[model samples]
Target: MKTILFKSKLIRLFIAFLIFASCSKDDESSTVDIPTVNYTATNFDATFFQTGNSTAPTIDWNGDQGTFSLSAPLAGLNIDSINGILSWDKTLPIGIHNLQVIITNSAGQTVKNITLSNPLQGVFTGFIINGNSEHLEMEFFSDGTIIVKLEDSGSPPTAYGTWTKNNTTIIANLTNPENGVQASFSGTLTIDTTAKYTGNLYSNPNLTDPLGVFEVVLH
Candidate 1:
C-alpha cells in the first residue's frame, strides 16, 4: 500500500511538471502583436511649382512616424525621411513630373503621387522676331523682375523692368537707361513640348500701337 501511494504521488508530480513545461512552450511560441499604422494626413495630392530661383514650396505631412522615400531621385530636391519635409534650393526642369512618395512603418506602407511642375519663369534665349533670330537673352525672375540683354548689341543694351502676368497674358514694362526708351510687351504664353510665347511690343504703357510681333522658345 505504501509503494502504491508513493507511485501515485510520483505520477501526479510528473503530470504537473508536464503541464508546466507545455504551458511554458506555448507561451514561448506565442506571436507578438504589432501596432497598426494609420496616416491622418498626407500631402501627396499637392502640386508644387519650381520657382526660378533657389526658393521652393514646402511639402507638409502629418502621420505616424515612419520612413519616407522617393520613387526616383530628383536632381535638386531634398526630402526629409523622418519629418516628411520636401525642399529644394535649385530649380527643376519644366513640365509635369510625377513623384511617388512612400511611407512605411512596422505595420504597413502607404504610397502616393506628388506632382512637380516648372512654369515659364527662367532664362529664355533664342528670340524669334519677325521670322528672324534676334539672339537675345531674357531672364525672368520670381519677384516679377525681367532683364533683357542683347547678345551682340554694344554697351548699354540691357533693359530692366517689371513683369506681370494674368493667366496666359504677360505684360512687361522695361526701360533702357542708355536711350531712355520705355518699352512694353504683351504676349500669350503657351507650354507644350516646349514653352512658346508670342506677343507684340509697344512703346507706351497703354499698349496702343504695336511695334513688332515676336516669339520666343525655351529649351
Candidate 2:
C-alpha cells in the first residue's frame, strides 16, 4: 500500500514537471526583441548644400515609431517631435556642422549622428579634353547656382546650371544656352594641400559618353 502511494505520487510529480516545462518553453518562444532604429530618409546622413539654400532638408526615421529630440537647440534648424522632420528656416553658417538626434520609443532609445555643411563655394579653373583641351572656369555660387565659362579670358559664362557636393564628390550639371547641349562634371577631390578636383566630363547626364579626363583647382 505504501509502494502504491509512492508510485502514484511519482506519476503526479512527473506530470506536474512536464506542465511546468511546457509553460516555460511557451514563455521563451513568445518573447520578442526590440527592433533597431535607422534612418529611412534619403540624403540624411551627410548632406552638403550651398549657403542661403531655401529648400530645407529633413531627417526621417525608420524601425520603431518614436519621439524625436535634438541634442541641443540648433541656431537655424527646427525639429518635429512626432514626425522626426528637421527643417531649416534661417540661413545656416558656411561651414561643417555636426548634429545628433535622440530617438525614444516604447522599446528603447537610440542616438544618431549627422553632418551638414556649406562647402565648395568658389571659382574652379580647369580644362576639359574631348578631342582637344579647352580652358574653362566653373564658379559655384552661394545659392546653389553654377556658371561655366569655356574660356578663361574673363568671358561670360557659356552655360548655366546647379552644383551640389556629397562628401568629397562634387557634381555640376550645365546646359549650353545656344545649342541646348547638356553636360555634367563629376569628380572626387584630391586629398592634398593643392585642393585639386579631378574627374571626367560626360557629354550627357547618364555619364556613358567617354570624354577625356579633366582636372581643376579652386582659386
Candidate 3:
C-alpha cells in the first residue's frame, strides 16, 4: 500500500512540474512593446564664407542631408529657403565677414557658417626666365591671370603661357601651333599679398614630384 501511494505522489509531482515548465515557456515567448525612433535632419558644409553684399557666393547644400533651415545671418538679413543655403546677391563691403547657416535631416539638425575675405592683393613684376640657372619668374595679376616663362636647358624658354588660380592650385594651358602640340602645366601656388610666391610646377596630372619648386618675389 505504501509503494502504491509513493508512485501516485510521484505522478502528481511530475504533472505539477510539467505545468510550471509550460507556464515558464509561455512567459519566454510573450511579445514585448517597443519604442518608436525619432526623426531628425542635418546639413553639410566643408567650407563656408561670406564676402559681404559686394560678392555674392553660390553655396551648394546638395539637398542638405535632409530638410533644415539657416538660423545665423548678418543683422537685417533673410534667407530664400529654410532648409538650404543663403547667398548675398548684393555686393558686400571689402572686409572680413561672418555668415551663418542651419540645416537638418531625418536623424538630427545642425547650424554652420563661416567668415571669408577677398584674396589678398599681390604685387607683381615683369616676366623673366633663366634655364642655365634653373630659374623662372612671372607676373601674376589679381584678375586671376598669369604670364609664365620657364626654361630647361642652359637657355631661357621663349615659350609664354597664361595661367589662372583656383584655391591653391594654378593651371597653365598653352598651345604651340607651330609645333602642332598642346601642353598643360599645373601645380600648387603659395602666395601672399606682399608679392611672395612658392610655385611647384608639374608636367602632367600624375605629378610624382614638383618638377620646379621656386620662390618668387614680386617687385
Candidate 4:
C-alpha cells in the first residue's frame, strides 16, 4: 500500500510540471513586440517668374513615405509621389500662387503650405542707352500701365514717360519736358535679374533716329 501511494504522488507532480511547462510555452509564443514610427516634414516659400525655359523650384522635405499629393493642380507643374520634387516645364502667369502639399504614411501625415510669387510685372531700374551708363527706371504694373524715368541734368533732373507691353515687346511714348520733344521706343524685353530691352527709338512718328539704339539693362 505504501509503494502504490508513492507512485500516485509522483504521477501527480509530473502532470503539474507538464501543465506549467505547456502554459509557459503558450505565453512566450503569444507575446509580441512592435516598433515605433515617426513622420515629419519641412516647409518652403519662394519667388519665380515666367521665362522661355523656366524651371519650378523644389521643396525640401524629410521623413516622407507612402503617398504624396498637392492641394490643387498647377498649370505647368507637377509633384513626385515617391520623392518630393516640384517640376515646372512651362511658364505660369505673373502673380502670387498658393498651394499645399501632403505626405501620408501608415504612421501619420504632414502638411505644408507653399507661397510662390511670379514677379514678371514689377519695377526695374537700369540704363536706357546701349552705350550710355545712365540711371533709368521702368515700372510695369498689372493694370497695363508702364512708366519710364530717365535721370538727366536739368531743373527736374528726370525725364518721365509712359509705355505699354504687348507680349514680350514694349512700346513707349516718352516726353522730354526740358526740350519740349516727344519720342517713342519699340523693343523686345528680356525678363531676368538683369532685364533688358533692345530695339529702335523713334524721334518722330514717321522717322527713326539714326543713332538711337534703345537698350535698357536692369540694375
Candidate 5:
C-alpha cells in the first residue's frame, strides 16, 4: 500500500508538469491584437491598418493637405489623430487631390496616401475694376472673354481683353476709352454668393481668368 501511494503521487506530479509546459509554449506563441483605422469618403477614401508587431501609432496633424480650395478652419476636411481616419464633410472638387498621412508605430513610421477624385468643379462670375474713379467694369466670360463697358461716357473704347487664372490668381487688363483710361487689375477673388454678374455686354475675349469661387453642389 505504501508503494502504491508513492507511485500515484509521482504520476500526478508528472501530469501537472506536462500541463504547465503546454501552457508556457502557448503563451510564447500567442499573438497580440493590433489597432487598425478605416475611413470613407464620397469622392475618395483612405484606410489605414496597423501592423501586427507594432504598438499604437503617433499622428502629426501638421501637414499640407495638397489643396488649393479646401483651405480653412471650417472646411470639410479633418483627420483623427488617434485612429488616423480621414473624413470630408462637403463635396470634393472636380480635379484630382492627393493627401498624405504619416503614421509612426512600434515597427516604424508608415506613409499613407489619400485621393479625392472628380472634385466638385466650381464656376463664379464677377468684375474687378481699377478701384479708381474710372467707373470701368469689365465682364468676365466663361468662354475666356471680358467686355469693358465705360459707364455713360458715350465714347466706345477697347472693352475686351485676355486674362488667365493660375489656380487662385486672377490677371485682367482692360481699357476705358470713354473715360480716357487703360489699366490692368489683379487680385484674389472669392466666391461671392451675395452677388451675381448677369448683364449683356458688347465684347468677347478668349481667356478663362478665375473670377471667384462657386461650387457645383448636386442637389
Candidate 6:
C-alpha cells in the first residue's frame, strides 16, 4: 500500500508540472508585438498648389504591413490604402489644413498629423513704373509679411511691410528702411493662367496721389 501511495503522489506531481508548463507556453504565444509606422513627404511641409487638376504627391511610407485610412473625410483630397499617397483636387481651398492619417495592423494602430498649406506665397518679379521703369522684387509670406526690394547696380534698399487680402483685393503698407517714409499700395490680384498682381503705389499714408503703377508675376 505504501508503494502504491508513493507512485500515486509522483503521478500527481508530474501532472501539475505539465499543467503549469502548458499555461506558460500559452501566455507567451498570446502576446502581440507592436509595430512602428512612419512616412516622408515629397513636398516640404506637405504643401500643394491648386493650380491644376489631379495633382498628387508621392509619400514614402515605412513600417510593417498595414492598412491606411484618413482619420476624417478630407474634402478635395484622397488617399490610397495599398500604398500611402495623397492626391489633391484643384477645388482645394486656399489656406492651411490640418489632416490626420491612420495606419492599422494586427499589432495595433497609429495616427499621424499632416499640415497642408496653399498660400499666395512666393517671390514675384516685375517692373514698377514711376517716371522711369525699375525692376522690383516682392516676396509674400503666408504669415502676411511682405518684403519689397528694388533691383539696381548698387545695394538697393529694402522695405518691410504688412499685407492683407480681401477676396481679390490686396492692401499693403510699407516703410522705407533708409528713410522713415511710409507708403501704401492697393491692387487687384489675379490667379488664372498665372499669379499676377497689378497695383498702384502711393507715397502718402492715406494712399492719395498715386506714386506709380506696378505689375508683378509670381514664379
Instruction: List model 1 lDDT by residue over 1-219, tens digit each.
Output: 999999999999999999999999887665333223233333322222332322222333332345777879875566677655556533343335577767666545666666655434677666636445566667777567998775444542789998887655988889987888888878887654556667887877799877777776654
| Candidate RMSDs in order | 9.0, 12.8, 17.1, 10.8, 12.2, 8.2
Candidate 4 local lDDT, 32-111, one digit each (tens): 33222222423332333433322333433333236667878976566777655655532454445676767666545667
For residue 71, give model 3's deviation from the true position in Å.
13
Best by TM-score: 6
Clashing pairs in 6: none
Candidate order by TM-score, decreasing, is 6, 1, 2, 4, 5, 3
Error of 6 at 198 (Å): 1.0
Candidate 3 lDDT over 103-198, as tens digits, reads: 454434555554534332333333222232455646554444545555545654433455655565656655443453344455444322333455
lDDT of 6 by residue, 1-219 (tens): 999999999999999999999999988876554444455542323332353322233333333466778888866677777565666764454566687877676777767777777665778889999888899888888788999997655667789998887676788899987888788878987654566789999987677999899999876
Models 1 onward score TM values of 0.46, 0.46, 0.33, 0.41, 0.37, 0.52
Reference-based lDDT, residue 178, model 6: 86
Clashes of each: 0, 0, 17, 0, 8, 0
Model 5 CA lDDT for position 190 = 35
Instruction: Point out the worst 10-residue segment of candidate 6 by lDDT.
Output: 51-60
lDDT of each: 0.63, 0.68, 0.45, 0.58, 0.42, 0.73
List where candidate 3 sits over 4 angstroms from the true fold.
1-132, 151-155, 160-162, 176-193, 205-210
Give one digit per residue, the lDDT tens place, for model 2 in 141-205: 76779888885345654899987777667778899898798889888865334556788888887
Error of 3 at 172 (Å): 3.0
Most accurate candidate by lDDT: 6
Worst lDDT run of 10 residues, candidate 4, spans 34-43
Candidate achieving higher TM-score, 5 or 6: 6
